[model samples]
Target: PLQLSQHRVREKEAVKQSGVKTAKVKGVKNLEEIKKAIDEIGYPSILKTCSGGYDGKGQWKLLEEKDVKSINWNENVEYILEEMIRFDKEVSCLVVRGINRDIVSYPIGENSHKKGILNKTIVPARVSKDILEKVEKTSQEIRKRLD
Candidate 1:
C-alpha cells in the first residue's frame, strides 16, 4: 500500500512538521537520479525503503553522498529520503475509543522494542510536566484524527 508518489509527497509534510531545516531527495528513480536526488536532499538523509518495512527496519542512514551506491537497493524500489527524527527518547501512547464513541486516554508511556518488536511499556512517564502536556495533547489530537 506504499504509493511511491504519495510517500514522496508525505516526506515534505514530515519535513515541515519536524520544523527542522533539512534537505530531502525529491523522487529518485535510478542511480543517476539517486545521485541527483541526494544532491538536492544533501547528506545525512535517511534512505528509507517505503514499503511495508517498519520499526527501524529496511532503513539506512547515509551520512555522505558517496556511500549511496553501497546500499543494495533494487532499481525498481523507490527510496524515501527522510531527515532523521531525533529525540531524547521515543514513546508510544495508547488511547481507547469505545464503540459508543467514548474516549479514554492513557498517560504517554515509554516504550522499548527488540528487533523492531514492541517489548514492554513503562508508565508514569518521567518527563517534564510541560513535555508531558505537549505529548499528551498531541496524542489526543492523533486519536481524534484517527477517529
Candidate 2:
C-alpha cells in the first residue's frame, strides 16, 4: 500500500501544496535553533516527533517563551516545531479503497479533544454543508494522490 496515507507523508505533501493551510513547521538541532524556531513559528506552537506517535503522546505545546525555556531537548531524537492552528471545531473522515480502484468515504465525524486526547466522536459532524463537503473532498483527494 502507499505510504502517503501516513501523517509524515501528508505533512510533506502539504508543505509543497497550496490549497490546505498546514502549520508552518521547521526542524532544529540545538537550543539556539529551538529559540530561533520559536521566534519564527511564534508562541503557542507545537513541538512533535515526526513518527511513531498516537493519541497526542509525543508532543509539547509552547504556550509562551517560558515553555520554550522549560524544554530539555534530547540530542538522541529528532523534532519538528509547528505553529499552532486555531480552529473552532475538529472533524475527521475515513476513506477506504479497494484493489479495483473503488473508493468509499464515510460521513465526516466531529471530534472533541481534551488535553490532546480524543474524548468523543459525533457522527456526521454538526458543521455547515460547505464544511462537510470540504472534509469529504479532502479525504477523497488524499486517497487519489496515494492511489
Candidate 3:
C-alpha cells in the first residue's frame, strides 16, 4: 500500500451571503448554539459536517432557523455546522504531495447541483476570463492555508 500519513480534508466552505448576519452563528457546541445559528442564518444556509459531514452530505438547506425551535430537545447534539454562502461558482481544487516530494494539482472544476445534490462537474472550467482570475486567486489563498 502507498504510504499515507494524512490525506484528510477538513472543510468549512461557505457561500457568499452579503447581507446575512454571520455573527449569529457564534458557536457550535450544542443545540442552543445551532438554534441560534438558525435564528440568524434563516432558512437555506448550508450546514456542513465537521468530520462526518461527507462532501456536504450532512449539510442542510434550512428554510427557517426557527424550525429547530419547534422540535423537542431529544439530545444535545448538533451537526458540525456553518452558514452557507451563495456563490456564482462552486469549485474544488486539490494539491497532493507524494513521498517523492512531488506536488500535483488536479484541475479546478466548475460544479453544478440538482436538488441539492452535486450533479455535474466540468474540469478546467470554462469560466469568463475575469472570473477565472478570481478563481485562481481564491484557490491560491486556500492552498496557502492548507500548507
Write one digit per residue (lDDT tens) for candidate 3, span 21-139. Answer: 23223335467677676666665655544434444465556556565555443344344445556668877666677889786777778888886778889998777777766666665
State the lDDT of candidate 2 residue by residue for 1-147, as single tens digits: 344334553465553463554678887656788889888888888887666655677788999878877777777666778888999999999888768968788888999988998899999899999999888877766556555
Segments in model 1 whose C-alpha atoms lie over 4 Å from true places: 1-29, 112-121
Task: For candidate 2, give the lDDT of residue 145.
Answer: 55
Give the better candidate number (1 or 2) by lDDT: 2
Best by TM-score: 2
**lDDT at 146 for candidate 1?**
39
lDDT of 3: 0.54
Model 2 poorest ten-residue lDDT run: 1-10
Residues 1-147, model 1: lDDT tens digits: 123224654545454454434444465556787677776767677776656556677677678866786888688786677655556766766778778989887888887777655677788777788878877776666445434
Error of 3 at 39 (Å): 4.7
**Full ranking by lDDT:** 2, 1, 3
Candidate 2 regions with alpha-carbon error over 4 angstroms? 1-10, 14-18
